[model samples]
Target: MSNSHYDTSFKGLCYVNRVRMVKPSKSDPYRAVTLSVKSGKRVSTEGKGDKPEFTIPLDCKVVGAQAQAIFDQILEEHWDDKKPPVISAAFEVGDIYPDYYVGTRDKNAGKTVPILKGRLLKLHDVYVKGERIDTPVETADASDADTPAAAQPETASAETREDRTVDAVAEEAASFPSVVRLSKDDPDFEERKARLKAEGYRWDRENKAWRRPAA
Candidate 1:
């Protein structure tokens, strides 16, 4: 299998016990949250009338400012409840890789068990019980009235801006060619190159271009 990174999105159940903050060391004070998302499908068993559900567990880490903030809010809301909340969320993950570790439980003791691991890039929506959470909105504070309107930064609301940005990006991506070439002479060459790489395009040395097959 190739080691190239790719993006994936899914809906899953997140148990409180499987979520926590991690600080590697005092020297490297960067913080991250680990989330275990359970997702799967049902499969019919031979000679059985019912379909048995199979669970696929993805152990992922959430980093970045926006994603981490969302994670923190979820923890703060339900971390200490008498009945731990099982959160349902839509997750966008990236750079997924196949990994394995020695199993310590019965039957699979001392044997390697495969696992899927990735970076939690974004959380589209979250729910506890049946109520939706994770709404991304920034409202103007009452104190803002005291400040001069001209001095206040001009920016679109978070939720509206993000939604439009996602839609724009999706529309642009759909118009992309199977392969893209860039010239250093372009003013935005560097920025476009970075964006292309993040979108799974690889530099083709021979062709002097970035290339990726169309989905």
Candidate 2:
């Protein structure tokens, strides 16, 4: 399949579980961490009552310096805790793919099932047990701080600054739109469609636009 067709991004609220650091091995020499994330929604049944909440399990590998630092702290703080930490975050995952395997035991001994997998790319607005964990921010080095303003990099031009200010205003104005309109002739249609889907936008055929209910 073409790479463009693959859903390369996903974002949602999930329960981060089973935090473990993987030691370097012959097969994979890099040090890494794994997180068992469960994300989904509850559905209602007509007259039968509410059906069980369906969840997609993603065994995602946590990589990159920022994400590793966050998980490293989590490991250090809760390594001895019996229960996994209750974590909620607006997170993003990338390089998603499906892995299929045969059932080894119980109900369907020989049945094949698929598991969704991805790499944990980012975690935002994270909270652990109702308390927020502030994401670390990068700061200038002490040496750079001591440098005079003249030694610092040149600032943006007035035109460029104005454009950026306008962009910031526009972005802030539309925090989350109720609908996203797209056309088949649009150059970035597929890319935008994939992104909108990841952001919980569903196609509204009647309205001829992608719609996401107000949260």
Candidate 3:
């Protein structure tokens, strides 16, 4: 357990090996996912460490229903034991708090470790000894309606409020650098752009697409 902050970019080939769960006195256990890179360098403000392997502990047991559903979707899509799913991850290390039920060893000790909160930004084929696993992983893309909105009862209302809040903030900040793009050729391009417009997104004529916040 170290007090050092892990504020660094951790981009590498890694695996969502497993989830570490912690139980409370009388509640469902909370789970934290363990992401590991067999060989990679840890980049921090102090400097970069040529660490052979970097294990990142992320807090995935989110509180909000919408968020938890998203996290669950991520897990269901990428984490499977029968056929290990590999991924190319791009993330930055954040904070790791002292917890009584977390850590590789001594689950109840309340150890403080540098936690790297991140997401599986990209999914890749599982490779062992530089060979791809034959068992095809399910790459079916799930729609937004299939997840967050439907996963929780409060998701639609919560999202509507959130969208309004973001819209208000974006308008007040006017110049805020929070924009993204969508191609006009996309199947739902028009509908998507219209929805984004209502959510504070705008058309970037220069980019030939719609734009919105990174969030």
Candidate 4:
């Protein structure tokens, strides 16, 4: 709302651009405006290589200019990549910058390790795995077969019928499934193999989850 917000020449003021911003400590939320960045780059330290974002440490005074510099450096590094500008760091709070004050180090000295800034500027929507938070699609609906509506009373009771179905299946496997103990090379082996093949079962090396090989 002030003129300095527009006047970007003030060195070291860092800000996420006109991106949907969320505060980590939601007890006090900041109003989103076009963020201004400054000179240096942010650092990352995550292992899974999570898309980096900015985070204010629990006990630190992050100067606006310092944050801006790091944010600008990150953006400049990826300016021509043709993808959404992203910070190339693993996932962790420390991934944004060093535990110590990295800003104090003189650039004239032996080049210090550059920090990886995260892309906290553009948060358009939130997702869990691949599903959107609002208007969530049911996982059962994601399957090829239609999820049959389980029978329930018009006037419901406290009992959970869904749990009952699972319990019933488990009980059947525990009790009656042992009746026919046949190895993989039984007379019905061909039929079983054909059924498994039809189901598109394949061995997954990374995760033991059986899946059809990608086409």
Number of the top TM-score candidate: 2
Off by over 4 Å in 2: 1-7, 23-25, 29-52, 103-111, 138-215
Q: Report the Cα RMSD per candidate.
A: 19.7, 20.6, 16.7, 19.2
- Tens-place lDDT per residue, model 3, 1-215, is 01232322234445444544445888754444565654555444445333344654554332222322333334433444465454433322323343434455666356655544543322344444344533323332211223323254554565466455777876766764456565657999768654654454433333443445334
Regions of candidate 1 where Cα sits further than 4 Å from its true position: 1-17, 25-52, 138-215
lDDT against true structure, model 1: 0.56
Give a tens-digit lDDT track for model 2, residues 1-215: 12233326777766676555344555542223334454345567888544336556676776433554455445534434566667766667777788977999998589997787776766777778768887745333211334345465658876676554777976864786887787769999779876775564544433456667344
206 in model 1: Cα distance from truth in Å?
A: 52
TM-score to native of every candidate shown: 0.46, 0.48, 0.29, 0.17
For residue 77, what is the lDDT in candidate 2? 46
How far is 196's C-alpha from truth in model 4 (Å)? 24
Candidate 1, residues 4-57, lDDT tens digits: the string is: 333444445443235643446554323343455554555667885333254466
- Clash totals in order: 0, 0, 3, 23
* Collision count of model 1: 0
Which pairs of residues collide in candidate 2?
none
Error of 4 at 59 (Å): 14
